[model samples]
Target chain A: MRQSSSTTDEKEIRETVAIILQNFSPLKENLIPILQSVQSAVGYIPQPAMKQVASFLAVPAGEVFGVATFYNQFRLIPPGKHPVKVCLGTACHVKGGNIILEEWKRRLGIDEGGVTQDREFSLDRVACVGCCALAPVVLVEEEVFGTMSPSAVEGILLRIRIEKERRSGCGGNEE
Target chain B: MKTITLTIDEKTVEATEGEMLLWVALDNDIYIPNLCALKARPLPDANCRLCWVDIEGRSAPVTACNEPVYNGMVVKTGTERVVRLQQTALELILSTHPVDCGRCGKNKRCELQKIARHLRTKLKQKRLRDISKRLPIDSSHSLFSYDPNKCVLCGRCIWVCKEEQKVGTLHFAYRGFAMVVTAFGGAPLGEADCTMCGRCVEVCPVGSLIFKNAEK
Candidate 1:
């Protein structure tokens, strides 16, 4: 069982890297764009993407993987369904956004960049969204909601839950 | 075989195959302001919202970056509404960013500084002091230091780090106010597995990431 699992993991990793290389061939000029696309497609750039990117570009896999793992931007794991980003940009921080973020941490029971236990939410902090007028803003799934609070977050969560239940119930009903 | 004519600032201009409405305006010397766009970079980010233009047929302002040129795409380059939107976007960016221009190395050279000077914004806008989170400046290499406090998070650094150098050492960490670009384990830039290629510092629009030599 252990051998099978290990092989499957390796296979999956290879496949992911293969997909990255296939989509972006001739690895030098398009190296960065290819990596960006891979990360966009799969939350973070996986090891497979690095290996394939390295081999396709004719660079060492270790070199490619080392670069991938070096930067702060690439993520290894699949990002959650909803990427809840809190604005920690300097302006937001000055305006008590940190306190609001703390409230979110307490409510969500996860630190920054942490996925919820159920994996429904992934919380991240952004440098700045450039929306300083809407200081203390939180972007949920790419939609910006300004002047956020813990209570407001709860309301947002409730809406998400209700939407999920509705989706599940409708699916069950159809079944 | 399709030709679309457009009017910019009341002057008639012609458009050819696959031209964006923005290119037409720029070609005609009608400058509609934008922040995230450089003629050098591929296209508009649409995140800055500085180049919102009012097209005749479009109900809402279409970003000049993404909007393709259609036949008779009448674009108003200098309208009060467009100016207001640009000002608002600028103000928002300013509110979160520090106003310590005197001390910043990019004092005269920053694109943001240029915009502020052009807009004649007094720097009187209420800035959020607490929003200025101090990120560990990666001084590992003798070449540069990345101060997260001044970063605008335009994703340009990310673009340069991964895209140009292919050294993925910098990334956006945490979400919201806690968000910053850092190496693994939040290590300083020097300690992180960085090649110190200086590409990320080169492309950053603001003073957040700077080359040590370039520091004023």
Candidate 2:
């Protein structure tokens, strides 16, 4: 059953690539946009997807892979439902950003750049969020939490839990 | 190409007009420490930032790898300021690179060792914190092995693989200090679609990529 499902996924990726490639003229310059469109359609760039991009762009597969890796914007794996980005820029670093990062790691049970087993949260260390005045910033999805401390992180978790309970109309240990 | 004359280290040399100063200096038997500038590359990568030189009219030192030479241009490769900047660049590279010359196959022949000796600086950087990642070594390939921690990210290997060999097996992934040469999706070299041309091994400047036969 798993093997058959994987084959179906492969077929889906190929069809997605074909649809995206129709918008591009197979020029080397269009590779990035093609990859971007592919990612938007499929959530992440799978290994087989890279081969499809290579063949469409008429570039080597390795070159496409190299380009994908060189840029920080690309991700090979699927992002979590909630991305937890901890700012580690120069200003945030001086403001004890690592301590906040550690607190998040402990609370979430995951290290930097890892998604939780449940696929709800993923942690990443960002270079900067461009708001230096709000040093030691943490972005939970689209919302930014600034001037963060360990206690503040706990409060944020509690809020998330409360919000979840309100949405589900129930609260339990499973959450 | 038109021929132009330039003075480097009190020695006059004739070089192609609009040629990069780094190659002209090296071709004329004048040494300027560099790790990223490749003769085969049409444009200089200048990622290493170790080829500092002072031209007569410039206020500060400039990297010789990209600077164009003109007729009668006076260049100084070993000024006090030039050496200091070069030393700082080498130190920054060493801060993230492991310094184990004794255990490395490229020990004596390593460009890092040669640059350090030239600059009279220690391989173990003193100022910067060691932010080196302990990435797993890929010994999967039968002919060569890769230790990402030892890589300097010179782009020579990548350029040689992608352009010269047209293999495109090796590539850089990530950003900031986390950037590293990797196979697609961080696959092991043996498992990747590598042709085993061994050109990447030949272009590696440090102990990052070593031939299996050369291992002790």
Candidate 3:
């Protein structure tokens, strides 16, 4: 069942890429927007999609990857169901943002720019979210937890897991 | 092309009207400490803010590589303000770069070393905290080796690989502090579509990329 589902996901990604490519002329200038659209359409920039974009635009795959990686807006990995981001801007960094990030990595068992084993969470450190007033901020999905501490990371993860379990009809417990 | 006359350091120089100010000054024997500006490839990435020059009627110093030459423009290349900015920029670049100069292959010929000597900035890199990427050396390529620890993030190699060589084998990966130049999918440089052109090695300002045969 898992193998079949993954294959279906791959098919869907290809179809989505084909649809996105049709909208733009095969020009170098369109590479950025194409990447942005692909990311918007499918959460993140997948490796296969980058290859397709490169071939479609007649550029090398490495060049496409280079442009994608140069910009902070792009993400190569498939983000998990709940994306976790820690702000490391000047304000946050001064307020112990690194400690908070370390705590999250410890709990998730993943380094920066990594996805959890269960595919439930992905962690990243952003330069800034323009919320300097809320230093040491952590964003789980769309919700922002401001003035966060290392200890707060666990509570946030637990709440997210419990909510996910309840929504999946598992009653927040697994035997 | 129309020829324009500009005064750089009180010396009049003639250049094409639309030529980059940095090249105009350089062609006329004027020196501007720059790393990313390449003469072969004219596109200036302007990431290195070292080529700042004081232009009359301009409030602040501007990067000469990005600014176009105009007739009767009075420019000062070595003003105190310009030198200070260049020194600061060089210091910032050195903070992240490894200071193992004696052990580096490009010891005497390194452009960064030349610029540092020209500016007379301290070689110890104590102004800012040192931040090293600590990436493992990539010696997989039969012809050359790629060392990210020594890279200054100058986009010259990327420009040569993409524009001049048209190979596009090397590219900038990640962003900001975690940024690096790597092959597609972080594959070994030898395994990538690289043609062993050596243009990247030639354009590299530091010892980040070097020929295997020259490795000491």
Clashing pairs in 2: none
Instruction: Write down the worst ten-residue block by lDDT for model 2 chain A.
Output: A166-175
What TM-scores result for chain A when each predicted structure is judged separately against the true chain A? 0.78, 0.77, 0.89
For model 2, residues A6-75, the per-residue Cα lDDT tens digits are: 8998999899989989998989999899889988898678889999899878777877887777666676
Tens-digit lDDT track of model 2 for B1-216: 899999999999999999999999999988899998888898878889999999999999999999989999999999999999999999999999989889998989899999999898999998999988899999999999999999999999889888898888788877788888887777899998888899899989998999999988
- In order, what DockQ does each candidate have? 0.05, 0.55, 0.62
lDDT of 1: 0.72
Point out the worst 10-residue segment of candidate 2 chain B by lDDT. Answer: B167-176
Give candidate 1 regions above 4 Å deviation.
Answer: A1-175, B1-5, B11-16, B21-29, B38-44, B127-130, B193-196
Cα displacement (angstroms), candidate 2, residue A88, comes to: 9.9
Best by DockQ: 3
Displacement of residue B96 (Cα, Å) in model 2 is: 1.5
Please give, for residues B1-216, the per-residue lDDT of candidate 3 as tens digits.
998899999999999998999999988888889999998767688998999999999999999999999899999988999999999999999988989889999898898888888888876778799998899999999988999988998889889998998888888887788889898999988888887889999889989999988878
Q: Which candidate wins on lDDT?
A: 3
TM-score of each prediction:
0.53, 0.82, 0.79
